[model samples]
Target: MDRPHSTSAPRVRRSRAEQKRETRDALTVAALVAFTRDGYHGASLEGIANEAGFSKGAVYSNFGGKAELFLAVMDYNLGALRGADWDPLAMPEASGSGAPEPSAGHDEDPARMVRGFGLAMLEFIATAARDDTLIHSLRARVQVLIDAYGRVAAAGRPDDEELPVDEVAQLMAALEQGATMLALSGAASIDSALLRTGLRRLVTPAAAANEPSPVRDAHASPLPDVERVRRLIRDTIDS
Candidate 1:
């Protein structure tokens, strides 16, 4: 019993760099929430710092200013989406591989989070359009996504196929941005499943796209039965 002595673990300390990184991350999360609530024009560094449980100086020290902070938030959110854990971009695993199966949201009400961030992002993009420097930064960040998409497109196509990466990326980006905005704006008909199908078809090889879809359902068709309509028209004409 005399040999039994309780010892406490030594206190571990974070280096200045580690502490700084932690502060930046906390600030980013708080800024994400604040930006979503107030947007880029309405939000303030002071409010974000307070939300993050830090002084306004922390935001200034970690980020140049609001523009920088917003970019950081964009990177964090968009990067997470691009990661292997999620496929928000509707990127196919292979060129013609079947559409990725839909999965449940990772968190409670994930759609809310998506809409919130999407709103803030679109607002900032609109605002940035008027600012050259800010737009440049935004373009650079967006280019990263486009580049990744180009790589994927190139991968899916045969080496002989003339897949203009830039063109392909531009089309995919346009579709993705437009589709996301529609979905976030409460388009009941626009969901991930449809988005996946649209994106999958967009990059599918010309030869494969002409072939009847291997999977068919109510969602697959976007219009009335044209063949049936044509047959009825012919019958009516004959009659």
Candidate 2:
């Protein structure tokens, strides 16, 4: 029997631009790993380049230096944190809709995602604190997150009943940073589910019954209760 001619098309070589992008992505990933393992001040461009199996020239060509690479890592990790796929049931409109949001992590474990990003963020913040230029840059990136939080809060409720956008953003930011500090201090008893759900509740203006919940027993983990955090935030503001 004559074997059918291979129908698969030949792979086209990547253009220079595409190859450069791949190299940049590889270098970024390697840099992130290296930064996490060795503190930012301790990590080197040479080490990162080697980790990516590329020459030190590739590091300079892609990121220019270690500071740039570290910022890139922060951008990637923070972007992921901000871009998490929140449950629709957590939405303000969920009160009228019967569709329930995923009880726990949605598609992936929120805890792991938050913890990893939080740790990296702490490291980046420490480095940025010492440098005036980097502090300004860090502030700019943080402003973006603050703006994003404001937008989400606006979407959740009517303008008349809506909380101050800045306050909402500040509250959410405090929760995240506090949780991150706790985890890093060996008190990781709290997980991301509580944080995610609590933020939804605080902004959505929905009754407790309509709030989305964890799919499994929340008590399974020793994490801080989302409701508690929500209450504290509310009380602090009201008081």
Candidate 3:
């Protein structure tokens, strides 16, 4: 007996919105890789689109242009940085959740992640220095992050901890940026112990709550030990 042949309809295509979201995600990923490798001025949208297997038209349709795309990539990297648990060694016991995972690559390393963020921040600073439009955009984004942090802090705080959430957020952001820049410059180095001590002072609630700070008193001490620590870091870097 001959079996009758039958055909089912082909699988349904993805919804237009799903397809668009996929495209945007792919472009974002490609842009991050490209920008990290080539830097802000060097990575082109056309190249990013090509790498993502999308057309340049697709990029234009999804984003306003290169600057907007660059900012989106910055946002993506920053989001990853925020998602990762920061190094427990850098904070007091109460402040630290856990040590951040070992980095699989430059994009994954916390220091390098902070460095990448610093570079993007530099771009924003440079643009804001000269352009009104970018200044406005930067201010709006800053406020949004601050407000978002305020909400998270409010939700997470215990009833008794009167945390100055916004100030804490600002200090953390500033230190990460400054530390990355300093590390990259190679002009000076901080020993791990000294680094941890320094960070703990700024990061823990005692200082973060806007109280009379130990950091203000600790600076009065001599730094012969700190200098030795700096030499060790330089030697490690040179090696």
Candidate 4:
């Protein structure tokens, strides 16, 4: 005889909870890739499940549906970009934290930037807009982000009726959404510089905080008119 045959090591059985957790994690990761690649409407539970090596039933068991799944994806990737670039407190330079700077290499591939996490985000926003229930589900999470944004807005600004931090935060939030939509669409060329400038200006505001305050002195300057003409001219050029 050559040698005695030895059995392989015993397989360690995982608990049901462990299996479920693992299953959910795997499914979520797969869903992330699917949503990123196909977007909200384009991604399917079956496809995500297949990608994760689970059956479609696995997704149903773990999540309410695709909307919930995407929300989980957002939660999973909160920093989303994973760079130290995010500071919900992306405050004014006065605080020392300073406003976020544009990524070092965003110009590399505009399409990739949009179609990556940005497209998935836009897709979910569109889906959420049509459904009150979905928007409601999103509001809590949005509130948390807005709260941090509000803090950034509130730092040096007053919370009074003049330059309500609430409105500033909300407006900044809207600008962010609108810009992401336009940037992702590729219908018109939009760039990070425009987004950066919008944030900077909005954070700083047209009216100096000390002079006439933010909301009050908006009309005290001719710059707004100049900007309007410039924007119109740019639009005409693009058209």
Candidate 5:
């Protein structure tokens, strides 16, 4: 009689750092989804931990507090959207009035950049509309944007005598937030049109003059509309 040998292979083990990163990423994704749905005030660390399949201590260890967690979520979401492939500097040139001359050594086309910005805004609004936690998190992000933009405008090129970057950022954030609120409240008509118009106006004052109305013409072909906008956003974020 002959004996058979076992054929099973040894399993590979993950390094501690790799395991930690995996756990951290899972927590961030869970938090993003949970916060978007529950809102910052409503979401609990325990709930996030449960969702992530981690313990409460894990959540606390990774993020000091709810605010830090919320900020991390924002960074996660925004970082997903930024990169050289979608470089702000490569956008289409603006052909309208009040367009800021491209800063020296900065050659991105303003028109395309504005369109991309509009798309990014619409995506954020859409996400917020679907998730209460995201909405709350975004409000905090808006405040940060205002403060950061204010400081930049005050310090860099103060003599430009333009609409303060902080003011523009706040206005954009408000419009996007308000539009999302309206959409969520059954106002489907309140889409990215307002944001597109505002951004265009902000980026190219001359273009604003050419078109008395910022809204794309009512009779104009829809151009695949909302889904197209969403796709662009997904591409930006996922890129």
Candidate 6:
């Protein structure tokens, strides 16, 4: 009877919920790196799983499919973008006369903020340019911008005021994609100089004034399909 003492210790109950959450986090991180490197079409669930040290079935179980995974990647990247290092000019306080000085904890500088945004955007575009899956995701983002601008125009804003939103969004997207491609191809420096210059020019009062107005009537010409065409061309070329 003494020799029959139980050999096994009591088992701790595993938290299935916690395990699932950790799995989802791993898959999302892996998808981000893979999509950034491989493009949306080029990246696969299997690849993401491998990157995350999980099985492909794990990815499928957690994310459903490529589209859902892509959305996850987008959310992850945007989150990072929003957390970028500070810039003073873009900070609300910087635009005001009574703005407080940069405290030891606060890094407020608008130019720096714009530059940070430019750099993050460039890095994202460069990564997407190399991956098929990511390209599709980027195309989706472009469509979103177009749709957003269309809505702004439809909301009865003055034609002149509304037009620049779409135009500026298009220009920013193009510059970002183009610059990323060029930088990746080793054709230009990846710094924000060119982007900053372009942004300044695009936002100039004269340039804004000169932009084509959104149509004012119900029968107004459809928003030019230029952004769609541009995205298609860029995707095709990158592919």
RMSD of each: 13.2, 10.0, 10.0, 11.8, 12.1, 14.3
Candidate 4 residues lying further than 4 Å off, grouped into runs, are 1-18, 79-85, 88-117, 156-161, 187-190, 206-239
Q: Name the top TM-score candidate.
A: 1
User: Which wins on TM-score, candidate 2 or candidate 6?
Assistant: 2
Clashing pairs in 4: none
Would you give me the overall lDDT of model 3? 0.57
Per-candidate total of colliding backbone pairs: 0, 3, 0, 0, 12, 19
Q: What lDDT tens digits, residue by residue, belong to model 2 across residues 1-239?
A: 99889889998999999999999989888876776666676678888888999999998887757777877876765564455543322422222266444455532333443344456667778878999988998888888777767767767755555568788777866766676577567866445455667676667656533866644444432233233323333446559
The TM-score values for the models, in the order shown, are 0.73, 0.67, 0.61, 0.61, 0.51, 0.46
Model 6: per-residue lDDT, tens digit, 42-97?
77889899999999999888986876776776565444432333221121122247
Clashing pairs in 3: none
- The 0-to-1 C-alpha lDDT of every candidate, in the order given, reads 0.67, 0.64, 0.57, 0.62, 0.55, 0.54
Candidate 3: C-alpha RMSD after superposition: 10.0
Worst 10 residues of 3 by lDDT: 219-228
lDDT of 1 at 167: 81
Error of 1 at 144 (Å): 1.2
Regarding lDDT, does 4 or 6 come out ahead?
4
* TM-score of model 1 vs. true structure: 0.73
Error of 1 at 131 (Å): 1.4
Model 4 backbone overlap count:
0
Residue range 105-131, candidate 3, lDDT tens digits: 521343343345456566656866687
lDDT of 5 by residue, 1-239 (tens): 87997799888899999998888899987877676556666678999999999899998888887756766766665545332232211222333597454343332222233333334445555666687766887677656645543443344323444776767656645655555445444444343444555544544456544765545445221221233334345446559
What does the lDDT come to for candidate 2? 0.64
